[model samples]
Target: MLATPIYIICSPCPQVGKTLIARLVCEFLLLKNGTAASFDVSLKEPSLLDYLPHITETADVIDTYGKMQLMDPLIFHDRVAKVIDLGFHAFDEFFKMCEEIGFMKETVRRYVTPIILFVAGSDRSSWRSYEMLQRQIPPGALVIIHNEFALRGGLPEAMVGEHVIRIPALPAFLKFYVDRLSFSFTGYLRDEKDWSTELHQWIRRNYTMIRDLELRVMGRQSYKPTAPCGRPRWHER
Candidate 1:
């Protein structure tokens, strides 16, 4: 059996498709394993819980009770895959609590890998936050996400060789349908007749990338090395 994964989809900047990626990961887990859960730590409207309320619970790290509620299940040895849609507002507090309590050490001991899918932004704050995460989390546990629509410019030279998962830009025609909370990626794959549509291809691309991420995390592949130059070395799914 694959090791249980706790995917924390986070970014210090809003509207960077962090929640969208979280939704995808949650749905992917549900379809792959038939059991999955998610935590919605966002203050934004149309968050992960909005899209997947049945499997998602609202979480907060601002106080002791809330922090325990959120972190306790994470250390469990159950095989259920967990996804956390962490928002910009809760980023600092959530990670601070993690560090304070030796969260990573506990998860490692439990055989539950905690992977941070950090959505990259062009701002300096985002860069600094990424750097801080590098220091706080193990290199293999930290994966950079590049949402094509969210990043206004290329990543800094410093981020060239990081383990990256890229979210492709959704075509204009498919965006309207996907924006609806009622739309489900797994449902579409099961029910859609034509598999050649842009939406189908887009969803498959993301699902493939996520599956590849899982395999790599399972130690089937080695972590990435520095790219030649200029080009960012993204993990090929």
Candidate 2:
């Protein structure tokens, strides 16, 4: 059986569409597994919680109390897929906690897989953050996200990961319609009326990409996480 998936959608740079990806993944998982939950660690408005309030809860990991509230539930393999929309502000602290508490090993032992869907950017911060995660998390668990809207110049080879998931940019005209909190990707798909529309086609392409990503993660060989030797100086740069 495949391990329960915990999709952590994160980016070290702000306003890079991290929450948009999280909303899509949460909706995708809900459709695929019939049950899914999400956490919004963002301080920005109109985050995952705002977009998918039914299944998303506000999360904070700044302090030990907040960390416990977030990590405790995730440590359990409840069989329900999870998605975390981690804000750029908490990016470093979140992973630091994971390393300190042996989170990767514990998750592996509990039949839970934690995959980091890192949004790729050309910024030095983005590049360095990706490099640091390579040492801290299993390579197989780090998936690069090529968000066309965010990175119009295209993906940098150095920032690429073992696995890549692309999010095609939607035309500005159509993007405005989907940005509304009331809008729903899955709901739009279910409506046969919009099947021939551009928005519908765009959503279909993204859903297909997400579906393929899940299958690949499931079929990939299992990984055993080892203790991180020491923190990388990537942050010092």
Candidate 3:
């Protein structure tokens, strides 16, 4: 059995599809026979809360109770895979609390596989946040996710040496339907849907990628590295 993962899908920039990636992870975990849930930290209505209402809840990291509500379960509950849809506003406080409380140590101690997926963005702030997280979190616990749908160009060879995952961009036409229609991937995939369409193919490919990732992390699979897509790593001027 694949070990359950705890993913914190985060980015310093808004609208870079952090929730989009989180939703996918949650769905994939459920399909793999692992229970999945999420903590929605976005101030407004994030897509995770909007769609996966049954699997997620609104969370805040500004106080002790909220931190307990968020961190304690992740550390103690080994049965459910959890996703934290971290937003821009709560970035600093969340990591601050984590670092101070030895969050990574506790997760490691409890045998929880913690994966911090920083959604890739182009802005300088995004890169800085990426670098900051690399420093704060335990080394090798960070997995940078390149959201090609909203970013441009390829990554800098120096930013992430290895273990980067890329999400291919959704075609504009498909994006239109997704934005206009209220659909759930888990529901749609289990029900009737064309398996040959671009959207379906895209979803399947992502699921494959995630499965490959899960196996790779647990030493059950291996694959050659592909050049990641997204903005190049930012260098200070």
In candidate 1 the C-alpha lDDT for residue 171 amounts to 71
Cα-based TM-score, every candidate: 0.90, 0.90, 0.84
Clashes of 2: 0
* Candidate 2 segments whose C-alpha is farther than 4 A from its true place: 160-162, 192-194, 221-237
Candidate 2's residue-wise lDDT over 1-237, tens digit each? 467889999999997889889988988888888999888899998888888888888889877778877887786668899899999999999998888788887787777888889998778899889889999988778899988888888677676445788788889877788889899999988975857788888888888988888877766747555564342222222
Q: Per-residue lDDT of 43-64 in model 3, one digit per residue for the tens?
A: 8563578868888888888777
lDDT of each: 0.83, 0.83, 0.74
Predicted candidate 1 versus true structure: per-residue lDDT over 1-237, tens digit per residue: 345689999998988999889988988999899989899998999888889989999999777878878887777658899999999999998998788777776665556788889999878788889989989998888999999877757776667788888788887667778879899999999899899988888899999999988877767423333333221111110
Instruction: Count clashes in each candidate, considering only residues at least 3 apart in sequence or on different chains.
Output: 0, 0, 1
Q: Is candidate 2 or candidate 3 better by lDDT?
A: 2
Clashing pairs in 1: none
lDDT measured at residue 31 in model 2 versus the true structure, 0 to 100: 86
